[model samples]
Target: MVVRQTVLVCVLAVLAYVGLWALFSGDETETPAAPDAMFLTDYSKATTGSCVKFNGPGENDLGLTVVDCKGSRAALKIGTVLPNTSGECPRGDYKVLRDTRHNAALCLLPNAEPGDCFEIDTEDIQRSVVSKFDCAAPRVNVQVVDVAKESCPEEAELGVPYEDLTLCLRRVR
Candidate 1:
């Protein structure tokens, strides 16, 4: 199933690239026009499980770069949030990374197992096309733990974070 999804994503990526290429002229320096309303969705408003570039933490107008999970720079995937957010992120793990004043929640891709540290890249990141190659590289390791109903299991260690609902975690040094 994963293989099929990977293949599908690859095919879709190729198609999207071809479409984008056709949208541009021969000038490599020419910037593509801003996306139309039909294509204005950003990472903050993307669907759950959608892979997105981890552009450090901020709530500025600099929109996120959404991409295929198979692609690189997919440091995080969108997670659940409170309802009625008007497409903005809610109070959650992603909100912490993004700090205050923004609505977004994300978890390290692949839902790290208990006591496991996930590696991610956090340097020289900016708005750009993120590729699968980026996922092959990482800069730091952080631990993740899944929480339920805002509470950890009795056996789970203490932490002070939350993501959507079933997940609150602390980054292990």
Candidate 2:
């Protein structure tokens, strides 16, 4: 009987040690923090004429240039943002779809897809007014241009641009 009790005690002690080590040693993997939200601004509100331009932080300290005008939609050669790796699958990892527009291009990634709803991060939206315009002034009718993918050669194509790629901007009261 004593031998049985001694063996049981030993087993229990070992289990306890393992439990304590797991709790204190931080053996569990720590989760990564979520990437910050991104935002968009209305091109109309920033510029007076038909065209509006903006830039942002991207991969390799390179920036992205967005040009929106009456009938033209082009994305200039800007830097890429570091791909998000916080989740099991990273967001923002993208491939260029094509290059045809002057200083403009298209890209494709899982995060940016058609029908994927995302909240805009107002704080991330930065602006430089190349031309000043009053918000209340007559708003120009701008049509977002959809570049043709066929113009790009098969090898140069990245992926189809999201159908709804327009930056949805809301006016602040």
Best by lDDT: 1
What's the residue-level lDDT of 165 in candidate 2?
29
Question: Which tens-of-lDDT digit does each residue in 52-126 have in candidate 2?
Answer: 123443322233333433222221222232222221212222233222223333322212112222222223212
Q: Relative to the unseen true structure, what is the C-alpha lDDT of residue 108 in candidate 1, on a scale of 0 to 100?
A: 29
Looking at candidate 2, the ten consecutive residues that score lowest on lDDT are 43-52
Q: Over the full model, what C-alpha lDDT does candidate 2 score relative to the true structure?
A: 0.31
Q: Which sections of candidate 2 miss by over 4 Å?
A: 28-173
Worst lDDT window (10 residues) for model 1? 122-131
TM-score of 1: 0.36
| Local distance difference test, each candidate | 0.45, 0.31
Candidate 1 structure quality by residue, lDDT tens digits, 1-173? 99999999999999999999988847667787754222213324556665555444533434565655554345445555323334444443343223223454333233333444444322211222222222223533344455466677654444434344544345334
RMSD of each: 18.5, 16.5
TM-score per candidate: 0.36, 0.23
